[model samples]
Target: MTMGSGGSSIVVPRNFRLLEELERGEKGIGDGTVSYGIDDGDDIYMRSWTGTIIGPHNSVHENRIYQLKLFCDKDYPDKPPSVRFHSRINITCVNHETGVVEPKKFGILAKWQRGYTMEDILVQLKKEMAAPPNRKLVQPPEGTFF
Candidate 1:
């Protein structure tokens, strides 16, 4: 919910927000570097999703495609979704064994606000791939999955 022009509360329903995200995902995000969609078209709640990120250039992950799963529970938008990489990766913010993006280690999840979207998360992960330390780190062979 947000305060309107007259200090009135404006609330965007969860399904409405997810639907908007779905539409944007279908239309394709900028540069096609990141994208996501509903995991199951039959899911009325729109809870599970699949995200893909093309690793940033000039990094070890360059040209590599990474897949991830996102689970948005009942409180999404108000609460961040659970993100886990399906493609194996070695990043400071991701758990080595389980591939989960650790909230305490990732600023986006740690300081989540209602305004953040799934696209934001995927894009940020791509940015993380280009950032220092991670850029030069050796990665598992391509096509490997968790």
Candidate 2:
């Protein structure tokens, strides 16, 4: 088990899969939908990560850049990481006050699989932004954070 930033503890097995995540993050995943890296590059056990998602083409979110932070605890992979947006966004799946994604509202978080990487989550979110209900809604100013 390992401790998180705020004194939270999580279980970390021998096959934590963190190294796998790091390599995947560094090498770049396909689709060009998103990109992520350790928040503090020097730390391989990288608990904090920052991600960017390119707004979908020809949409209200087009040409916009969304920034997010993902916190992976020792229980990550086994349990979904805590995801928050440093950029303000009004979507059903996100908590307005905390910027935390709602696992129940976000399918990937509720039904997480080990094979799913942070890229999958970002791509899925970009898809969600274009979803019918979200697509029509006006967004807050860019760079506005929660």
Candidate 3:
């Protein structure tokens, strides 16, 4: 099946299931909202999703809104989704390779499992922002925006 506007095609089983979960989550299955996009004709299965993260309580990010992006490949579900902070979040734990902000202090992104949904990742990111282990840590260099 294909979704969105990139011509990307998703094989029926795993990728389709993940897409369904994303739709459900957008419909209020979880805390935040998620939006998805796919190419028009390609079968490569590259999907992109956007979501919001409510800053954690009692922290610098608390009450502030953050944006998140999720990139899923054709092999999704079998492999974890690539997640990153879309809004300006200054942090050091972000993976230099994938450009996704890593809340290593909480070990959530690092411990991602296949059964995890996009909602799970968003929730974990919110938890990490709410109570980061190193609140005093400074954001990485200015050009690190992904």
Candidate 4:
């Protein structure tokens, strides 16, 4: 495995063996939806990832493919990754303060725990998008395409 900069050793827990698979470029266990990639820095950690969720199988998002992005920190595995929708999502409960998509307005990202993983977060986000608590909300303003 690639070592972290500054000579600081990265600790891996035995329970989360998937981390090793990720480090070795193996696909996630059970669900291939979760994957990893290196960012511009070439860090050995799963700094970025992408996945698609099939709506909710029967909900509004059913049959719809939803894209997602996961940003991992240097101290990953011990810290939850920040996940966001790669595609446009219409929701009115977003946090104006952080400019993040907060459908529940409960600030789930802000309350992330170290035990969380990219797969875990993506699963939760898919569930929320499929059956949003506030379905009547309008989509966020679209950005101009260059």
Whose lDDT is greatest here?
Answer: 1
TM-score of each: 0.96, 0.82, 0.65, 0.57
How many residue pairs in model 4 have overlapping backbones?
1
Question: How do the residues 1-146 of candidate 3 rate in per-residue lDDT, one tens digit apiece?
Answer: 44656877654587567657656754664434333333332544647766676666666665666666777777777666777776667555556455576545336556766666667777766665545563444544433445
Model 2: per-residue Cα lDDT over 12-116, one tens digit each = 552456766668877876766688988886766668989988788867788889899998887777777889988888888988888888999999999998667
lDDT of 1 at 38: 97
Error of 3 at 134 (Å): 4.2
| Predicted candidate 1 versus true structure: per-residue lDDT over 88-119, tens digit per residue | 99989999989999999998999999999999
Residue 45 error for model 4, in Å?
3.5
Model 1 TM-score (2 dp): 0.96
Q: What is the alpha-carbon lDDT for the whole of candidate 1?
A: 0.95
Residue-wise lDDT of candidate 4 within 2-103, one digit each (tens)? 358998766555334445535633444345433443343354454666555555554455455556566666656565555556655554433433435563
Better of 3 and 4 by TM-score: 3
Distance from true location, Cα of 128 in model 4, Å? 1.2
Ranking of all predicted structures according to TM-score, beginning with the best and ending with the worst: 1, 2, 3, 4
Clashes (candidate 2): 0
Clashes of 1: 0
Q: Give each model's whole-structure lDDT.
A: 0.95, 0.82, 0.60, 0.51
Over all chains combined, what TM-score does candidate 3 have?
0.65
Given candidate 2, what's the lDDT at residue 76?
A: 74
Rank by lDDT, highest first: 1, 2, 3, 4
Worst 10 residues of 1 by lDDT: 1-10
